[model samples]
Target: MSLRVAYGARRLFVYLVALVTFGAASPALAKEFHVLAFGDSLTAGYGLPRGQGFAPQLEDALRRNGVRAHVTDAGVSGNTVGQGRARLKWTLDGLKKKPDLAIVALGGNDMLRGLPPAQTRADMDAILAEFKRREIPVLVAGMLAPPNLGPRFGAEFNSIFPDVARKYGAALYPFFLANVAGVRALNLPDGVHPNFQGIKRMVSGILPSVTQALNAVEA
Candidate 1:
């Protein structure tokens, strides 16, 4: 072959190699993790404007923390643990792909409705079991029962989340509403769902656990 042609071929091969190497190492080429924020109105960003809800805020936070993630809000307002378990399949089917990690944040509505804690625990177990069967990692966002519910009820209800999470070997974010639960300024007028800032607080409180879960998924 002519020297000119040989030199050109060598340069082309080197350029192609560089391109492949860059693609392998580039953040833009990294896997986009899928996270399902499956819960009730809290995850749905009830009373908050677009982009201010838990899912979007969490997604933005993850990106800021140098993680590429698409958080899907599978939350339904007023959804109980039983309802969430029942609709788990439908929600998963609607997703374009199976979630790499799922944040199960139900049972709040069940507590509010004065449902039996045993029932809540069972449904939560079912939900986590489904995710396990699909081989998806999970982070259980717990909910605390109000004092008005009485000590007996509170004891049973509050234990539901941690118990289920332990049983499934899932990561647990002890309380979803950690710092903003009853704060007047953080909550909406109804005092049930969080406002914009409240959602931010929730995302902040759970961000570390989420990052840990994402790391596990990548691993």
Candidate 2:
């Protein structure tokens, strides 16, 4: 209880508090971020080999760009937007912790099956709403209805991703397929699934948005 002793103790406590605060806020000291790739076959790597899927490839890409991330593949082949919404809670429950960032990439199958655009929009809205309710940051990996789907249907289906993303205040990567879609060489024989090269291209295109989303999560 001497004056000098009390003063030293106070200073030490302040120093410790500052250290703890900095450690918590410093990105360099942060734990690995968990990212959920919540989508369908394109996100699932349907025809590709192990480690070549969107989730794994994206994880590797994030690391290469200096962000520590573990991407979980919640993608299932043949999943429509409605199916994705149905399984959303189950998939989230399976994770050890809630994802730091979620990439919503569903609806391709819905378009392929010729489902109504309104149904697709509703399913997407519910999915994004759940994420928002949980306070999870999202990067919507949008899917564009093919030109063959007819102009009106394509317009309506295509509008769902951006509109939902805006409503949820989420980041949008306009088209998940981007450079790889419709390229015969980049697709598998079935022409719906991406090949190894296609996966790489997709990863490259989306890496920037993923990084931005992680930055927001950290912030």
Candidate 3:
């Protein structure tokens, strides 16, 4: 995945979620659905071990729920939305085939660094434009700006996800970390990244929206 991001608006600025991904090849990639989990630390599975990260776990969940899919982890830890846009072209080029759907989750780093929300929106626009140009259906996994940053900042930052999703005609998740944030036991020691059970909660939360997007695009 790209860096870190997901869940819903309430899960913002606290817990992490799946970002888009760009990694090496994997076996049996020829499934009914091919997805790219793009974002930051959440998708990269920063602290967790192999097969426990968002992409792999989500893939397992998808299969368990009866959708045959291979999710590629294309996350770049510490990346901003601009950075995610910077690498999008090459990432797509390097892929063996264009994915059926791309779950794009970014902008948290930009929000954390106190960068302009307009900038994040602009970069997101470019990223989604490219996806549309390439004929790829994208599910824009949303993020809420942390409340500590103040309401104005929150309004500006939070609106970016849905605004871009609407302008680009992408499916919107409205927030990637819906039920996992704010709960102490669900997070890691740093009070940010989710624990194993937390990720499961995220997977469960977003699975329905993800399934809907997949069906809409593939149909």
TM-score top scorer = 1
Clashes of each: 0, 0, 38
Cα distance off (Å), candidate 1, residue 75: 0.5
Off by over 4 Å in 2: 1-27
- TM-score attained by model 3: 0.84
Over 162-211, each residue of candidate 1 has an lDDT whose tens digit, in order, gives 88899989999999989898899999999888999899999999999999
Give the higher-TM-score candidate: 1 or 3.
1
Q: Residue 90 of candidate 1: its Cα lDDT?
A: 86
Candidate 2: C-alpha lDDT: 0.91
Q: C-alpha displacement of 135 in model 1, angstroms?
A: 0.5
Report the lDDT tens digits of candidate 2 across residue range 1-219: 999999999999999999899977785646799999999888898987888899999999998878888999999999998999999988887789889999998988998899999999999999999999888899999988888879999899999999999999999999999998889999999888899999999999999999988988777
Q: How well is each residue in 54-137 modelled by candidate 3, as lDDT tens digits? A: 898899999998788889999988999999999999999999978999999887688779999889999999999999999999
Best by lDDT: 1
Candidates in order have lDDT scores of: 0.92, 0.91, 0.85
TM-score per prediction, in order, is: 0.88, 0.87, 0.84
- Order the numbered candidates by TM-score, best leading: 1, 2, 3
As a TM-score, model 1 comes out at: 0.88
